[model samples]
Target: MKLIVTCLFSVIMVYSTIAQNVAISDDGTYTADNSAMLDVKSTSKGLLIPRLNSFEKDNIPLPAHGLLIYQTDGEEGFYYNNGTPSAPEWITFTDESNALWRKDPNKNVTYLSGNSDSIGIGTDSPSARLSTDGMIEAMSDGYKFPDGSVQATAVFPANFSGYESAADRRWVIAMCADEIPGSWEYQGFEECSKVIDLEWGIYVPYEPGGGGVTGNRVHKPITVIKNIDKATVRYIQELVEGQGINEIEFHFFWINPDTQQKQVYYVITIGDVKVIDFNHDVTHVGNEIFSHVDIISFAYEIIHWNWLPDGIEFQDNAIGP
Candidate 1:
């Protein structure tokens, strides 16, 4: 019995030494001896068992897997599942290649390309071209009349003929013009009294060339009466007494029938009266004496000329010799 107990204690010591000798290699594979206990100093390799007393099935192939790792000086090292043997820095699936790629558990994939210093994903191709010359030409090519020109002419109404006559219904003719200051002269009429028996006369307001140059001129005629009676004179006086009469002075331009030079006719009417101021005393006049005097009515007429041409050019000032 003493010899059997000593043999059991020696077996227990050997088993304890084998269990503590188990080790793993640098390639992540484990190795051990076939004994139920692992061997520490045994140089020979064999099937790896994960732990002491763990079960092992013989002749079964070991499962194999791979990992890709990257190393840079300043960046942390990481691993990818799809890296190829040729370009371990880039990873690819069956369809596309990616560098520094990752996919989350939700299946979203991201990748980086270009210099490792900068990175981009989901970007492709480049941008489309504008004309600077056409704009400059349009701005360069973009209408450029004199002073004191006139546009239209002046006209008078069509129905105007002349003023009504005072004597025998015959129309009186007259014309008006601006007189030069010293050039206006009057002949064959009393001062302020324009009545005259002559065929023609002139009224010039200045001493022949004083006031200014004439702008417009018109022609008109006067009505005349041959014989009148005293009763008619009295009746005419009754018609015109106390009524205001217009004092019209005339400047007439008459063409000589032979010489053809223009001669001016002037006349003035002071008080075109219906009543005669007889010098004879009204109380002393016998009925027979009053029978001889006669009354006459007279008026001036205006004649218009249409011969003046439109757009006539004239000197700014009248020419004087």
Candidate 2:
């Protein structure tokens, strides 16, 4: 009993002596730095801070100001709460500045300045009253301008004519189509045909001859005539009759230049008449046809009656300005 009491008394004295400063080091004799509450010194090791994910770090209850922790996810770095416990503002110690925008308690809104300064959302530098690198969406509210004018949801004009000054509407459509991939391909092109269909429009770039030692090739658009039908199936039938071949099997792939969608074409020439017949029944099969003539007819109806085409998947409905 006496030995037990003596050991407890010794432990208390050692703790009391080290209460002012605590030093952890390889060598037991090293003293702690006077400024730091707990000093850890090592030559071959590093001081590891508490690591937590964004969810765990944010859920810390009443975290004190100046509390530091290493976050593992969502802009991972060391974070310290600069604000008080009741209104903690945890900011990254890694490259975070005092002028950095502060997210509100709801976390939905972020504010860089309270007043007397320009505000920026997606950009750090602001050249105007409000500058953003991304789109600004106003949900269930109208926008008010500096001129004291309020604007609600804008609707397109009833008689709106697009690009009144432009000479060609197709050129404008092509320009708009260039911004997005898979807008359209050559019309009446087969989805599985191996040959390149010239009907779909293929732009081949070539260098023009000029008065120079070496000709530098420059790309330029060339006008092409769509006259493949003039090749005359009658001429092909005459040649086939001379050879006495009753049936000639031929398949061609066609791509819609406007939609970039491929359509399959299978043709069989019989006798000297060169009569055309589709493998699938015209009326038996569904509206979706892989034949060239059928697709052209379908496109005509789509443009004439403003009907929707099949196999079109929609994404975010945004038009470029």
lDDT of 1: 0.29
RMSD of 2: 23.3
C-alpha lDDT score of every prediction, in listed order: 0.29, 0.40
lDDT of 1 by residue, 1-321 (tens): 999989876552233333555543333234555563544433455543232111211111331223433323223233333434443322223212334444444757554333233322222221111112111112342200132222211111222222222222222223222210111122321121111122322232333457664543321223322112223333344445734233333432333322223333333333232222222223425432222233233332322222223423222111122
Regions of candidate 2 where Cα sits further than 4 Å from its true position:
1-19, 97-321
For each candidate, give its TM-score against the true structure. 0.15, 0.27
Residues 115-188 of candidate 2 have per-residue lDDT tens digits of 44787777789867776654354575434447322221122112322111222111101100111122123232
Alpha-carbon shift of residue 140 in model 2 (angstroms): 54
**Reference-based lDDT, residue 141, model 2:** 45
Candidate maximizing TM-score: 2
